[model samples]
Target: MEKFKKRWEITQDWQLLFPLIGIIALAYTSYKISNAVISKFGVIAKVLLAVALFFILLRFTLFLFKKLENKWILDQKWEMIRVFIVFAITGSSSMFVGRPVIKLLGITKENLNVFIYWILFIIIGLVFYQILLVFFGFLFGQFRFFWEFEKKMLKRFGLGKFVN
Candidate 1:
């Protein structure tokens, strides 16, 4: 327990609960998604696919957490988990925004060339992602951290001159 706190840079025992809650939430969501798949496929196939997906999501989360840990200026290690949560929310929100925009523009995989559709989709998604990153960050109580991150991202894309 002590080592865990130290590694995560958590100061109090109660702070551990955040990560615990995050883990439980992730597990529950994975279970629900797996069950949804099971309804469409056979038991054996769905079970294997679900298990594979669960691991993949877990690994991806960990990878993102580590990447954020390196890039963001976090006060504690456990905050990486929060950052991960905000990032996931922003990404999903971006996709949600992008989908409607694409539909509104009458751009569909069936109508447009597949390559063109995807390029437009990704471009729209990227724009929404940048906007949502700060909105969600503020909602998550990590505005400063995400604001800095957004600046860095924009700079990397050659848009830094417009930011400040």
Candidate 2:
């Protein structure tokens, strides 16, 4: 417990609950996903794969928190959870908006080659993702962070010229 607190720089004991719950939730999700993929495997293999995936997901979550820590406005460790939630919403929103637009445009996997269909899907998804990032960020009370993030992303995509 002390080590976990020190490692994450968490100040209060109560603050620990969110991360702990997050880890357990991630582990359970990993277990469920691994089970679906490895249902034919032996119990030992399934347990091993689930454990491995849990650790990988945990590491990924930590890495993502570290990377985005500076970008988020709140300095508290628990805020990482909120940031993650906001990102999750933004991502889902992007997909929600992208799929309908693609269908409306008659851009279906059945209509185009698999490669082209995927390329178009990704392109459209990316555009919706950028737009929804800011929209959801605003809804989540992190408008400035996402607005800046959007600008940076657009700049990288060579659309900076239109930003000003």
Best by lDDT: 1
lDDT (Cα, 0-100) at 71 in candidate 1 = 74
Q: What is the alpha-carbon lDDT for the whole of candidate 1?
A: 0.85
List where candidate 1 sits over 4 angstroms from the true fold.
1-7, 11-17, 32-71
Which tens-of-lDDT digit does each residue in 17-93 have in candidate 2?
Answer: 66766777788888998899999999888889999999998899889888878876676767577557667667777
- Report lDDT per candidate: 0.85, 0.81
**TM-score of each predicted structure versus truth:** 0.75, 0.72
Q: What local lDDT score does residue 136 receive in model 1, on the 0 to 100 scale?
A: 90
**lDDT, candidate 1, at 41:** 72
User: Model 2, residue 145: what's the lDDT?
Assistant: 68
